[model samples]
Target: MDRISALRNVEDALRAFEEGDVDLTEAERRVAATLRTYASELDGEDDVFRAVGDPAVDGRVVVAASAPAARERVLAAAGIDPDRIDDEGDVPEFDVERV
Candidate 1:
C-alpha cells in the first residue's frame, strides 16, 4: 500500500485501542502487520534484508538498496558502532541476506 494508506491504517489501529475496541496487544499486532506489509511492498531498488551471525545484530530487518547497506543499517539499528569490538575483542560479525 501507499505511504498515506499505511499511516492511515496504523492510525486506525491506534484509534481502536484508544476507543477500547481492541486491547493493547491486538493494537500492537495490527500496527506490526501494517508495518510489515508496507516494508515488504516498497518499490524501486530497496529490498528487505535480514541480519545473521552475531546475536547482537541478528534477526534485524532493514530496507536497503544492497546487502552492504543493509548490514550498516542493521548495525545502526542495534545501536552498535560498526567498528566496536565484543567482549572477546573481536568486531561483531553479521551477514545481511536478502529476504
Candidate 2:
C-alpha cells in the first residue's frame, strides 16, 4: 500500500488500541508495517521515524528531540510541507517559544 494508506491504517489501529478495542499484538503488527513503509518512503538520508512509547490522535510518530524542530523534521521527512503539521491541539505543541 501507499505511504498515506499505511499511515492511516496505523493511526486507525492505534486508535482502536487506545480505546481498548484492539489487542497489543495487532497494534504492534500494524505499527511495524507502517513504520517499515514509512521508512522506505524516506527521501532524506538522515530521516528517521522512531516510535515513542505510544501513539495518539494528534500524532503517531513522535519526533525524538526539541518537539518543534522534530515536528518540522517529521513533516519534511514525510514529504509534507513543514507549515502543515498542526500542533494547536497537541500538548507541548510545536511552538518554538515554548520549546
Candidate 3:
C-alpha cells in the first residue's frame, strides 16, 4: 500500500477506537496489519520480517535479505550489541519470521 493509504488505514483504526466500534486490542491489531502491509509493499528485493520470542526484540519489523540479517537488524534497532555479550544469556534470543 502507498504511504497515504497506510495513513488512512491507521486513521480509520484510530477512529474506530475513538468511536467505541473496536476495543484497544482490535484497533492495535488493525493498525499493525496496516503497517505490515505498507512495509511489505515498500520492501524491494528484501523481505519484511518480524522478531519474536524475546521481549527486547519482539514485534520489531524490518526488511532484510535473510532471517539472520533481519534478526541482526532487530537487535541493532533495540540497542543490543550482539558482540558485546557478557555471557550466552546476554544475547537476546529471538527468531525472525517473514511477515
Candidate 4:
C-alpha cells in the first residue's frame, strides 16, 4: 500500500477503536502493521526521516529529518504543510501507554 493509504488505515483503525467497534488489542495490531509498512517505505527512500505522532491528538503527525529542507519534503510526502505546524511546543509529550 502507498504511504498515504497506510496512514489513512491507521487513522481509520483508531477511529474504529474510539467508537468501540474494536478492542485495544485489535487496534494496536492494525496500527502496528500499517506503521511497519509506512516505516519500510521511508527506509527505502534515500533521505532519513522519522515519522512521529501523539495519541492524544488525532491525525497529528510530524516528520523529522536531518535538515529543515528535508523535513519539509517529508511533511509534503505525508500531505502535510509545514507552515500548518504552529510551533514545536504544540507537539504533545510522548505517552507510551496511551499511544
Candidate 5:
C-alpha cells in the first residue's frame, strides 16, 4: 500500500484500539506491518530527523534534525510547547527503533 494509505490503516487500528474495539496486540500488529511497508517505500532518503507525538491524538508524524532548534520546531508543529516537552515528565511516546 502507499504511504498515505498505510498510515491511514495504522490510524484506524489505533483508534479502534483506543475505543476498546480492538485488542492492543492486534492494533500493534497492524501498525507494525503498515509502518514496515511505508518505511520500505522511503528506502533512499536521509534519516536525520525525528518528530514526537501521540498517535492516538495526531495521525501524522514528521521528522527533523536532532539540532535543538529543529527539535523545538518539531515539538511546536505537534502542538506541544517545546519548553514543556521535557518538563513535568511529559515525554511523548515514540518508537526509538523507528527513529
Candidate 6:
C-alpha cells in the first residue's frame, strides 16, 4: 500500500484501540507492534520507528527522523516486508536565522 494508505491504516488501528474494539493488553499490543513494523517499513533507514515499551496496554512507540523522507524510509525498512512507500507528504522547512 502507499504511504497515505499505510498512515490511514495506522490511524484506523489507533482508533480501534481508542474505542476498545481490541484488547488493550493483548491484541492492541500486537496491533501496535504491527503498526510499528509497518511504520518502519515505510521509513527505512532515514527514520527510526521502534516500540519503546512493553507490548502491554499503554506501551509507547516513537517515530522520528532528521528528515521527513528519512522518516518514510524508516517505515520502508520494516523488518517485515510491506507494500512500497510512495513518500507522500509535505516536506518540512528549515530556515537559519541570524542571532
Q: Compute each candidate's TM-score over C-alphas.
A: 0.84, 0.35, 0.70, 0.41, 0.40, 0.30
Model-by-model lDDT, in order?
Answer: 0.87, 0.57, 0.89, 0.60, 0.61, 0.45
Instruction: Pick the TM-score winner.
Output: 1
lDDT of 2 by residue, 1-99 (tens): 576888798899999999999899989988887776665565533343342332322244533435555556544544666455477633322322111
* Candidate 5 residue lDDT tens string, 1-49: 6777987998899999999999999999989888766754554433434
Ranking by lDDT: 3, 1, 5, 4, 2, 6
lDDT of 1 at 6: 98
Better of 4 and 5 by lDDT: 5
Which 10 consecutive residues of model 4 have the lowest summed lDDT?
90-99
Cα lDDT, model 6, residue 8: 76
- RMSD values for the candidates in order, in angstroms, are 2.1, 10.3, 2.6, 8.8, 7.8, 14.6
Judge candidate 3 at residue 41 and give its lDDT.
86
Give the winner by lDDT: 2 or 5.
5
Q: After superposing candidate 5, which stretches have Cα over 4 Å from the reference?
A: 43-99
Better candidate by lDDT, 2 or 4: 4
Check candidate 2 and list the clashing pairs: none
| Least well predicted 10-residue stretch by lDDT in candidate 2 | 90-99
lDDT of 6 by residue, 1-99 (tens): 456765677677778778888656755575566666665566353344333222221123334545444333333333322253236632222221111
Task: Point out the higher-scoring one by lDDT: 3 or 6.
Answer: 3
Model 1: worst 10 consecutive residues (lDDT sum) = 83-92
Query: Which prediction has the highest lDDT against the true structure?
Result: 3
Which stretches of candidate 6 lie above 4 Å from their native place?
A: 43-99
How far residue 87's Cα lies from its native spot in candidate 3, in Å, is: 4.9
